[model samples]
Target: MIGQISEASPEAPYLAANLYLDPAVISALLIEMSDMREPPLDTGFRISKADPELLDVWRRLIGLLDRPDEVPVMAHHFEHELMFRLLQGPQGALLRQIAGTDSRLSNVRRAMRWIREHFAEHLSIEVMATIAGMSVSVFHRHFKAVTSLAPLQYQKHVRLTEARRRLVSEHDAAATVGFSVGYESASQFSREYKRLFGASPRRDADMVQTIVDPGP
Candidate 1:
């Protein structure tokens, strides 16, 4: 059974509606939501009022979800189309900037790509700016505009994500994973990781394992 919506507030009429969302569909939606340019609204819904195009997309998405067998592939296509439509909206200026040549957005995206590819290595904004063919100030502005985070923050996120992956797959010591992800000191890594993820690495890894393989 689908979950209930709490209230009949004017803010969200659809809140009471029964919407059957597949796990894969929910995951794809979450991923796309995270990468969207717009800041989140009050409620979980995408926009204040649903656009016809977006509703159509959602309908198709729900249709795909109804067929459990085809969900994986259909979810991918739905997410792609949803993202494409979102990028066509006003907030998608960041995407357009990145696509256009000689734009600061393009340079920031280049720097971001480089950082993502080499996240395990030590990184400096100066070096990244050079790679992007821009000055430090210009790179910082555009990068923040596109991602709502500074370069260092972005690097830290990449490192934390990689560390979490390594912790789960390799079952290495938290410190070891930290060092592998470019931290020189394990203590510093632990502190930062805890701050970002709200738990110590060991606890987080154990939680992940439990979620992945819940015993009957």
Candidate 2:
């Protein structure tokens, strides 16, 4: 779900710690905890400032890295505590939906996976609706509500995102990359690419390349 992640600073280098939550682990904990479920959230993602208890759990979890031998035994426990603390936070509702198999957020995520996989193909709203197991109108409404983008609009975002990656990493021609991403007209691709990225494809790639490999 994370397309890109980075940290930048003018003085000291940026430093942070992160964790990956296992849905199985979360679901197991949910079984023991009663009345933890909440109404479905329009969006699955949530952000909250970590409180002291959550920070303490994070610290203990990070400490495991230093004691590699203990990690095999204790890491899972710490991860569970971490998720438990999170489930008690403001983000709890969103996390609960993530663990629900039939939640609307899950259905939307299913469709999102499909879009990411078939982004270069012609987008079919009907197919996306079916994938989400909703009628066309219902799917469109829910998709937009959850993701803030219509189906075709989401496809455009996926296409442009991928085009950026291919341009930067593969150094392919803009037109070729555009065609490969289902854009029929090179000019249309360039125009939209600029609209989204604030620069033409080649220019943005060059800019990124400059940042990546600055010469002496």
Considering every candidate listed, which one attains the maximal TM-score? Answer: 2
Q: Kindly list the per-residue Cα lDDT of model 1 for residues 105-153, writing each as its tens digit.
A: 5566678889989998888989988988978997777677667788889
Write down the TM-score of every candidate: 0.63, 0.89
- Candidate 2 structure quality by residue, lDDT tens digits, 1-216: 433335565785665676776778878989888875468567655567999999999888888878999998899899999899988888888778878878787788899999999999987999999999989998898899888899999999899989988998999999999999999999999999999889999999899788766689
Whole-model lDDT per candidate? 0.71, 0.86
Runs in model 1 with CA error above 4 Å? 1-50, 58-88
Point to the candidate with the largest lDDT: 2
lDDT of 1: 0.71
Clash pairs, model 2 backbone:
none
Residue-level error in angstroms, candidate 2, position 33: 1.3
